[model samples]
Target: MAKEVSCPNCGKPVEWSEQSQWRPFCSERCRLIDLGEWLNESHRIADPTDAPSEDPPPSDDLSTPH
Candidate 1:
């Protein structure tokens, strides 16, 4: 039997098998909606470090004059 999973966006039951093109999503619409959320910054992956990313300090080593 194929494993069943709930759609991440719609809570619809989905079959975890080769036929499930969208896999975790119920349909293309649901997938697009989820994509839109990420694109709009409504969804974000939790940073494991739990700290805002910062740019590395500029290197002080001066390059040899070309």
Candidate 2:
């Protein structure tokens, strides 16, 4: 059995381990298009939730200090 997922390029359905030469992509053209979209900032996902916690940086507090 093959797992299914959406094609990142055109939002089409595709299957994992599918009979495709492009594998993750539906086709070679779609793969290239996806790459171009990434380069152009046309596509983006959630922020790095995997980011590590860090100390707060120096900044002026805008509170009324009540």
Instruction: Tell me, by TM-score, which candidate is best.
Output: 1
Could you estimate the TM-score for every candidate? 0.60, 0.48
Candidate 1 residue-wise lDDT at 42: 36
Candidate 1, poorest ten consecutive residues by summed lDDT = 42-51
Per-residue lDDT over 1-66 for candidate 2, one digit per residue giving the tens place of the 0 to 100 score: 778777778777777874866757888889998788786563335345545668686565664343
Clashing pairs in 2: none
Global lDDT scores for all candidate models:
0.82, 0.72
lDDT of 1 by residue, 1-66 (tens): 999999999999999998989988888899999889886663245544556778776666565443
User: Clash totals for all models, in order?
Assistant: 0, 0
**Model 1 lDDT, residue 47, Cα:** 47
In TM-score terms, candidate 1 sits at: 0.60
In model 1, which runs have C-alpha deviations exceeding 4 angstroms?
A: 42-66
